[model samples]
Target chain A: MILRLGADFLVAVLFSLWAGRPGWPGFVIGLAIGFVIVSTSDLAFGRPNHGRRLLWMIHFAGYFLAILIRANLQIAREILTPGFNQTPRIVRYPVQDLDDLQVTVLANCITLTPGTLVVDASEDGRWLYVHCMYAEDRAKAVNGLQKLDDRLRREVFSW
Target chain B: MDTVRDVITVILLGSGLSFMLIGAWGVVRLPDAYHRLHASSKCSTLGLFGMLAGAVVYIGTVDALIKAALTLLFTVVATPVGSHILAKAAHSRGLRQWDHTLSDELADDQRDGPPQV
Candidate 1:
């Protein structure tokens, strides 16, 4: 944990330098910010394989960016064109295996993606009620969400 | 180099403005609140990011770039969460879906009691 904190501090200092503050004061500030971030995260989530986690985070970010852009374009088309191709409905998605943090991340990802927004979670957190804009075929809509869930489970949370 | 930067900025700003316009139009055009939220949240997020990217590019300063990047990051994390909460509240309060909606599984689940473990 201490090693991770040190590494994070160094990276933060480097970031400060890259951000155009070239001085001892910037380094001190960076170290302070880094300490706060690292400690807070450590408190939230226990120590894990940092290198593997960072790699998966990068992977997730790239995949998420592509989908995010696609979602924007899809909405733009819906707006620019004359009529709507929307078949909105709410579906109950099972979230049985995921813990709280994983569920939160999954919910946010679903909301940000194309045509899906998380409406609520069941009292037990076993299911997420999702509002899907394009649900003409219920199975397909569920399948799309299932795919995202599988990827997140495999890539990010497997550690 | 300067010309390239200017052109990029123009493109970014133009796209961002158009996206914001479309989001506004969608809110006016869509059938219901839920659908409107989709348009407003998604488009505005991309629109804001585009404008921020333009600012970062135009300024070409470390401070400006970092600030813009931080704003983008926060928006990326916050926008969806905010929209989710709003949508959840709307659903719980029985905000109506569009008339043409195909199914209502969530309503069914709510009415039928919680699912079996």
Candidate 2:
């Protein structure tokens, strides 16, 4: 809850600064408004484990950028070349122990990465169906997803 | 230092535009909805990041820099969720893949009545 409030305060201050009023008074006002909204929302939806998530956010930002750059370059190369060698396939990724939020985060990470799109999650949220543009080596792709899931579970959920 | 910043800004802007163009090309050329989402989401997110970085360099104000950073963060977090939803919706609607699709584990799961996960 405290971390969420801090994040909200940061956003509010940034917004105020972006609005061309970068002063302490504006920032204080923004912080107050942010606190109210964040507190109420936290009340409605159970408070997030924000400290772990904040740490994960920092770690994931760097990791995400590295992957994003590589994926962008790969897709750009594929697009520029002729006769793309994509072997698209859908793979079922098991999500046995993680809760819904973890599964959702894992799924989003999969979609954000190039060459993979999370097509669906089972109603029970125990499985994520991911479509891979390069699926010639299915086991390798699933292994990659597994590694990402493990990292997220470790860093974000500490599970 | 100013000249260096200008050069960096140009490079970032050019790369960002190039990624966006590539994403547009992929949208047109990709064979299926899911494939298009794969291309569009990654490319656009990276493109926006690049462009925003360029803007931050060019503006060189604390406020502008903070805003750009926020935009990039939000984009990184939000784009995947947007793509995930679109892909899920397309799949649930029974959107067909390209004729050459190599595997369909989800379809198989439907037939087999959900595997023991």
Candidate 3:
């Protein structure tokens, strides 16, 4: 639980830097607000087993940052190259092994991926409708997405 | 020289801000969250990016240049994220569209295909 609090605090500090939030005062306030948010989640969900959750959160953040870097590189290449890849299609791909927040996280991860955008999801959350700029292998891509979803959504978030 | 840079910066900043302001208006005035997201996500980001770029041009330091590049990169990443989550939430909450949304392709798959598990 203390680890979770510290991890959440780190997240808050990173968020402040990312947001360009003014100064030390702003950073402190940001952490406070983040603390409230984390505490509430703990209260509501009764907190995940302490050590495992910390490990997961660290792993999750690292994985996310790495993926973000990769995605940006692809986008940059696509923009610069201008006519290399084609296979744009919007399709609804089925998903399993997740809940709402995980699904949400999955969908956003898709959106962040350069070649794809998550257009919508099914009413029952059975499928995520994705429009891929280069939709070569939906199965392969979705599998990659599932790996990410499992690591980030399942382990880190305690979802 | 300074005047020229200032004018260019002003134009760039104005263009970006206009995109953002207009997009924000679209968000408020547009009929639905989906379309509004279309406006806000697409336009506002480009706007913000443009504004940031303009500011970067004005500052023209190595640090500022790196920061601007990072900003552009991350905004591209984050905006779509936010939009996707909102769209998913809307879909889950039964927010129907104004028009027939072409066809429910995912729904079709469930009935026709074998069980996926």
Candidate 4:
């Protein structure tokens, strides 16, 4: 908890610095904003799971950024190249283990990533129908989704 | 040092514009709605992010930096949700996928009957 609060404080300090307040005023404002951030996150995301949650969140953010960049490059290549290499398909991706929030994150991440979009979900919420822009091999596409699921399950939703 | 910052900003802005151009081209050239969504949403998200980043670097002002950062953050978070809702609505409305589409398990499952769960 202390570490998480400290991290939030650091982020708030950076924000204050960016906002042109430096030195003592910035520190004071950072302290206040940091407390608000910590409390608000607790209220929104439920209680933190030890100090590890922050580390996992940082890891997730890095991974998400990497994937976002890769997704864009892949799309750009497709757009610039000659003939279509796409073999699009809508595949059912099971998400029975994930709760509502986890599922929501997964869906959004899938949509944001390379060559995949979340088109729909099953009535029971057990499955997400993803449209893959390149599904030349079905298992390969499903495995990509599974890797993302594992990452989320291992990192963000471990609690 | 000023020259270095200007160069970096120019590169960022140029790449951003090119990405936006590619996104527009994709939208026009792609065969169907889902493919176009794939193009427009992802590319434009990154393109706007790059442009905002360039703005932050070029402006070199605290207020502009904060505003650009917030804009980028909100764009990153919101774009995917918007595309997801659009894709779902299109699917539910029976908007046809490209004829060459390899498979559609959603339609197959629906055709099979009510969802098992």
Give fnat, all candidates.
0.67, 0.81, 0.21, 0.74
lDDT tens string, model 3, A77-100? 443453434454446777755688
- lDDT digits (tens) for residues A98-148 of candidate 1: 899889999988987999988889888999988899898889999999999
DockQ, model 3, C-alpha based: 0.15
What ordering of candidates by DockQ runs from best to worst? 4, 1, 2, 3
lDDT of candidate 4 over B16-103, digit per residue (tens): 9998999999999888999999998899888998899899888876567667977987887788889988988888899977888999
Give a tens-digit lDDT track for model 2, residues A1-159: 346757787777776777677765666677777767776776678766444566676897789788889888888888889886889889998888878777777777877776788888888878889888888999998988888777777776662
Residue pairs that clash (backbone atoms under 3 angstroms), model 1: none
Query: How would the candidate models be sorted by TM-score, starting from the highest?
Result: 1, 4, 2, 3
Candidate 2 chain A, poorest ten consecutive residues by summed lDDT? A48-57
TM-score of 4: 0.83
Candidate 2 clash pair list: none
**Interface Cα RMSD for candidate 3?**
8.0
Q: Which rank order by lDDT, best down to worst?
A: 4, 1, 2, 3
TM-score of chain A of each: 0.74, 0.69, 0.63, 0.74
Alpha carbon lDDT of residue A123, candidate 4?
83
**TM-scores, all models, native as reference:** 0.83, 0.80, 0.48, 0.83
Of all native A–B interface contacts, model 2 reproduces a fraction of: 0.81
Model 2, stretches more than 4 Å misplaced? A1-57
